[model samples]
Target: MIPQLIFLIIAIAAIALFTINIRKIIRNINLGRPEDRSDRPAERFMVMLKVAFGQTKMTKRPVAAVLHFFVYVGFIIINLEVLEIIIDGLFGTHRIFASPLGGLYNVLIGSFEILAALVLIGVIAFYARRNFLRLKRFTGVEMTKWPLSDANNILIIETLLMIAFLTMNAADYRLQQLGAQHYITAGSFPVSSLIAPLLPNSESALILIERAAWWFHIIGILAFLNYLPYSKHFHIIMAFPNTYYSNLEPKGEFSNMASVTNEVKAMLDPTFTPEPVAEGGKFGAKDVTDLSWKNLMEAYTCTECGRCTSVCPANITGKLLSPRKIMMDTRDRMEEIGRNIDKHGKDFKDERSLLNDYITQEEIWACTTCNACTEACPINIDPLAIIVELRRYSVMEDAQAPSSLNNMFGNTENNGAPWKYSPSDRFNWAND
Candidate 1:
């Protein structure tokens, strides 16, 4: 009774903490301006099913994809064992499902053991790729110290958790073979049976090992759950929603702000009446809040995979821009703003904007308005949209642009083209 009560308390506490952190993240995501992505419900659902659930984009790298698919499937399917553990822990029962399901339980356990072993292999391969083999995409500038350490930490945690699960099974199987009380001779252990012989056969020692492994696996899962909010692994939860809310418009089409579009329409149509502009109104995104809520959500959903940067034309040509860096910077700035809001009030104003503080003008302008970053992102994160907004702010609000851009803007205004010539002279070049 006491053991059941203790386990229940700990489980409830972990759940409460996880729920609170999830709420805080949602609150931060809501801090951005409103966006309507409510259109095309059926299409969005299919996209989510394909991209997030199916992992279609991840298959672009077949070798890594196969390993990742095993790890992902194992992580999800192995949780059935966790369900059994939870039930056993709550009721102080031993292998509760084994007696009821009989042969099926044995098959399930056998399959879980095989998957757990495969998960271990996959995680080891991932660790080797990141640390030893040093995959260029995983070792880029944005993947410096903390990001690298975080990736390694997750892989290590996964490896340890799988080991704990198998070790617990091995210990339990050994105890069952010894005809120990409450140790049912039920579920089959294909992989753990191989491990069981290596373990000491002492009854007391086996009990200790089983209990310790059980505790380690459950406690590690709880710790990992809370850690997701802080780590890039949070995408495991956010990816579905992010993919569903992805921009489905033409890749080359830029979304002009509603206010800016109305202003432009007013000028074009003399009969159109524009809303009165408030003095000192800002244009484009000057801070995190100026961006749409979907833009902010993209930051939370970023896996930091560097696929966007790997295929980026600017990065390929040795320019100062990295789309991965742009996403990371946006996320960092959003986090800073969230922290400030927590300390102050919801309407708290920060002196630092995302433009000069987090991302530089050089990086923004280096982009050729190409959608390569969008195309390469497995989760459909649009880093170019953020870049375009920042660029608009620099040109319109700050009135600060490169000399070449200024000349081009002047030519467009006067000659209706990007060349410094009269409209009649456009035909003169053809005549020459």
Candidate 2:
């Protein structure tokens, strides 16, 4: 009973900390301007199902897709066993679902065991692929510090957790064989049976091992939950909503500035009026708050896989424009702002902006507006949107642009097209 009480307290504390962590992230994401993503419920749902849940986009690389699918599926299904663990821990019961679930419980436990082995294999393969083989995508300009360490840490933690789970089952199975008190013949253990013989034959050692492993598994999961917001592993939960709220427009379509579009409409129709900007509001995104909420969510949703960066033509051409870097920079800037708000007030100004501080003008300008980065993202994150927003801020608010683009804008204003010829020369080309 005392053990049960301790488990209950730990569980409650973990839940409270996780809630606080999630709320902080939600608030940070909300700092961005709001845009309606509630339209087309059916289409959004289908997109979420296909991209986020089905992982269709991840199939671009079959090897990774297969490996990641094992880990993803295992993570979901094996957690069902954790439900039984929680019940047992709370009620001081052993194999609480064994009788109610009966033979089906055996099948489920066996399947989880197989999945555990698969997850172990997948994690090992991934770690090897990242470190040993040295995949180019896994190592980039941003992969040196926390980004690199974060990925490896999650991999190691997952490996340890899976090992602990299997070790607990192995010790439990051996004890059940010994006809030990409270250790009944319950769920099947196919994979762990192999490990059973390798374990020490002493009942006391086996019991201690089983209890320790059980505690380690549960505690590790709780710790992982709290660590997610600070790590790239947050994508495991953020991907669904990020995919669902992702832009559904055609690739070639670019959203027009609402301020300019409304002004044009007001000129064409008497009843139309342009919406006024709030005081000190700029034309484009100079900081995280200027982007749409979806953009900010995409920032946090990014797991730094570098899939977007690998396919970027600009980066391929030796440009500094890494889409992965853009998202990481935006996420970092957002967190900085969130911390500032927490320490000071929401209205507190930090002379630093995401545009020049985190992301560079050179990096943003190098992009060709080609949607390749958007297509390559596994969870449907639109880093291209953030890039465009930054470009807009530069070109509009600061009136800063490359000389070539400035010339193009000038030509368009004078000649009705992006050409050096005047409007009077429009008919001269026909004669030529």
Candidate 3:
């Protein structure tokens, strides 16, 4: 009865957490963000499938990718074993996995255990690279906020999972030694075989140990479930929708702004107005709210894996713009605005003041509009688009442009290109 109660409580809590978080995630996704339409339907689907299932990002580092792939597959398949364990605990049955397909179940369980061992080895290597090797390119100028804490948490979770695996096997072996049904403990689990000789030949002790292992295993799973949303594991849930709604077009597409008359009318109107659609009103994002929902989603889905920053040409050449940090800033700003809107109303203005006070104009202008950041992003986050939009707003609307940009614009407007040479020069060399 106590075990049933414990199961019920944990199950209820897990369902509640999953429901609430999923609702928030879905609502955010449905916000109708703009996306580029340049990609063919088939191409877009292929890219999504490749990134989501093939794990293209993980493969960037070959060894780490292989290790992670096994662990991911094991974790996904182990849910079935978890369910079986729970059912057996509640029903006092040891023959649940002894049906016609019992052999298949055993095979899966065995495979998961082997993969789990490999994952542990991989995580150990990751820890060494982060802590001891301390690669300058990975760490960046600003230290990661939770470097030590993140490492500790990852280690602890892996260690506890390994212990749970061992304990389950050990208790099963002891049960077999006490003459429990052969179906319950048939052919030895590798880890359990090592411990069989150490247990006393006492049936009562076997039962107690089995019950204790059940409790420990369930508790560890529940703890992990509860902690998932608040940790880096948050990506596990975010990755699905992030991949589903990712931009499917050419990376250079920016949302065209509405015409001036429509924008001015909306600004002057007292009643709330929809976004303008007139031609040439403005050509890019002026503020955070001006960004499409897809862009906003990009901000939230970022794993802060530093993959974008590591490949950024600017960062490699000692520039101030780290594409990873830019995405982080956008997310942080959106969250702040969300809080303010929640406190006030949708009509709540003064968003520009908040953004200007936080993000600097210099930082905004330093961007070279190079697409390196977008090319490097595993999740297809286009930081270059966001930067370009900001530049358009600063120059056209605010009448503020850096000296270099101003000179380039002048050349383009007057001569159609930034080059000083004349187009007629091409014919000079073609004379017969």
The estimated TM-scores of all candidates read: 0.96, 0.97, 0.80
lDDT of 2 at 353: 95
lDDT of 1 by residue, 206-236 (tens): 9999999998999889889988988999888
Candidate 2 Cα misplacement greater than 4 A, ranges: 265-280, 427-432
> Who is ahead in lDDT, 1 or 2?
2
What CA RMSD would candidate 3 show? 5.3
Q: Which ten residues in a row have the lowest lDDT in candidate 2?
A: 273-282
lDDT at 144 for candidate 1?
76
Model 2 scores what on Cα lDDT? 0.92
Candidate 1's TM-score reads 0.96
lDDT for residue 292 in candidate 1, whole number 0-100: 78
For model 2, name the residue pairs that clash. Answer: none
lDDT of 2 by residue, 261-336 (tens): 7668888998976677542367779999999889999988999989999999999888888999999999999999
User: Cα lDDT for residue 62, model 3?
Assistant: 79
Candidate 1: give the clashing pairs. Answer: none
Ten contiguous residues minimizing lDDT sum, candidate 3 = 25-34
lDDT for predicted candidate 1 compared with the true structure: 0.89
Assess each prediction's global lDDT (C-alpha) against the native. Answer: 0.89, 0.92, 0.65
